[model samples]
Structure formats: C-alpha cells, structure tokens
Target: MIQATELRLGNYVNLNDGSEHDKIRQISGIEHKIVYTLIKGCRFAQVHQSFDRIYPIPLTEEIIIKCGFERSEYNDYRHPILFGTLTLYEGVAELHISDMYSVWVNNLHQLQNLYFALTGEELEVKI
Candidate 1:
C-alpha cells in the first residue's frame, strides 16, 4: 500500500486489482488523499480508485532505463536544468547530483518528487 500524500501528479504506481498481474499506471490526479489514475488500453479511461489499490513501483534498473537515463552513465544533460547520475548499489537506487549531493530513492513516486523538487518540472516517464 502506498500513501496518497507521498505521491504527486505524474508519478507512476502499480494498480493492484487483486490479481497476480500488476498494472502500472501513471497518476493523473490526487485529491483529499484519493488517487486518480488514467487506465491505458484500447481507449483512455479515467478511474478514481481507492488508495489500497495503489502500490509503489519499486526502483529498479529497468525503471531507470525506462525514464530515459542510461545505465552506468552519468547523465548531465543541460547541466543546470536536470543532471544526475543514477546508480543501483546493492539493489538500492542512488541518485548522485554531484560529488557531495545524493539521495536514496526507493520508489518511483519518490524519484518523481525529488526530480520535481530540484528541476521545478515534471520528469517525463516512459511507461
């Protein structure tokens, strides 16, 4: 279960529909501790779901690559705009902004929040 308060618009989360299969969805909106998601399919559908259905997508090598960041590469594109080196150490994601500044991100939403906090822009996530 994921706390709705910890998430923001555009964060990715897994929608647990009580099936073994997990549906990854991007958060479209959040209000009053309720998370709203746009379900993707043959047609775009908006669904207001209970917080119990929302789960944090674990930070992984595949997730980082899906975000357009290259593996084992220092991504410093547009310097002051958005630049960080993402590395997984012992199965944990470490985002190194510089030699001295770094943060441990455990979930997709947490990474989104951190990126937004630093760049003042929504991180484009490829689902």
Candidate 2:
C-alpha cells in the first residue's frame, strides 16, 4: 500500500474542458480509494457558467493507484461505483464523492496533461 503523503500532485486536466486550471483541495478516504475535492469556481467561465448542484467526483482504482494513492488502505471504505453528492456551504457550492465514479470523468476531467507535472518520473495507470 502506498502512503497518502507519498502521493504527489500529478497530471490533472479539467475534464470540463481541455483546460488545466483545477485546484485540488483535499484527499480523504479509508484505504484503497481516496476522495479528491476541487476548489469551488476554479474552472473557466464557460465551465462554471452553467453550474447548478455540487457533487463529489469518483475515480477508478486504476486512476487513483496511478496517481500514487495506496488503494489497499481504504479497502473497507471502497464503494462499488462512482456517485456524487450535492453540498451547500454559505450559499456557495461544494462537491463530494459519495461513491467511486465521482473520480471517473462525469463532473471533472483527469489531469493527464499534468502527469509530468510531478517531480518524479512518469507513472502509468494500471488498466
């Protein structure tokens, strides 16, 4: 199992668009999977222009492991599939991953462009 601290920021792409402008807020989970939240309103005008509810985006084990998060840690908290949740904060908006697909590619995109952004060598996602 990979340590959470060992996981560094990697290639992140704004799944909403082809832009690379999403700020990762925090990562939390039990073990095998981790939950990644984005700062509200970090996307381009076009992407945020039509925003409505806030929900968590789930990612697959392949993507999470590839990003350097230890999947074995949260085996107990692992959800079968991707799911989203709507959260309201100070009348603003927030997203939370209630399940795994939240990290997939529905609300946000993978940071494939930022892959090399990490200081270490390229790490490939296991299929």
Candidate 3:
C-alpha cells in the first residue's frame, strides 16, 4: 500500500474496495479530497479522505494501454530532470565529502548530513 503522503499527481490508486471496477483510478487533484478517476469505462470518479483506505495502482503496460497515455507524453525530453548520486562507505565513518559526480560518506553522522543536504529533510537512521 502506498501512503497518501507519498502520492504525486501522476500516481494511480484504487480508492475503493478491490472490485473489478475499483482497481484503476488516477490521482486527479481537482476534487481536493483525493479524487481518483477510473482508467477504464466512462472515466468513473471517486473521492476519499482516508488515504489508508486506498491501494496504489501499479502502472502495468496493460493499465497504461487502458488509460490511453501516449508514450510520447512521458518522454524525458518533454520533462527534463536534474539528478545526483550518493554513496556510503562503512568503515571510519567520520566525514562527508562530495565531488561533481557523487557524494561519499563514511559514517552515520555523515550519512544523515548527506541526506539532509540532498533532500532538505532530516533522515532518521536506524541500526
């Protein structure tokens, strides 16, 4: 199950019980209450607030075909992205350092620091 907080505008989910008609709804935000429009049939729509009640619908090829999503619309050139990589080294975990290609970390403190630098969110590390 995917949490509501993790949902993005393009994510699909099942907003109702797992019935045949309840399986493929896209997360259209217009309804504000977490609305989901059906990927099949006449575009049936449903809304719910209890995100826990929803199950994220996986985007299988069949579902994509059913949804009529043109492959060209999902092209990388149409939606450019900037990305980075982070790596961790277990021994002598002390300092955090970075170069143009990657970030290297030696310990838990360094790991948390790198995570914060990249995501702007404090990461809770668990041993």
Clashing pairs for model 1 are: none
Model 3 alpha-carbon drift over 4 Å, by segment: 18-21, 30-46, 64-127
Residue range 1-127, candidate 2, lDDT tens digits: 2233333443232223234543333222212344333344544222221111112234544445444444333331222232233232232222245444332222112233223332234545332
Model 1, 65-117: lDDT tens per residue? 66666654443222234576777755567777889998898888898898889
All models, RMSD in angstroms: 3.1, 15.8, 13.4
**Best by lDDT, which number?**
1
How many clashes does each candidate structure show, in the order listed? 0, 25, 2
* Model 1 segments more than 4 A misplaced: 42-44, 73-81
lDDT of each: 0.78, 0.32, 0.40
**After superposition, which runs of candidate 2 have C-alpha atoms over 4 Å from their true positions?**
1-58, 66-68, 75-109
Scored against the true structure, residue 53 in model 2 reaches a CA lDDT of 18
TM-score of each: 0.83, 0.22, 0.33
lDDT of 3 by residue, 16-117 (tens): 664566554555553434445444444545454455556644323333233222233232111011133222122322122324354433323343344456
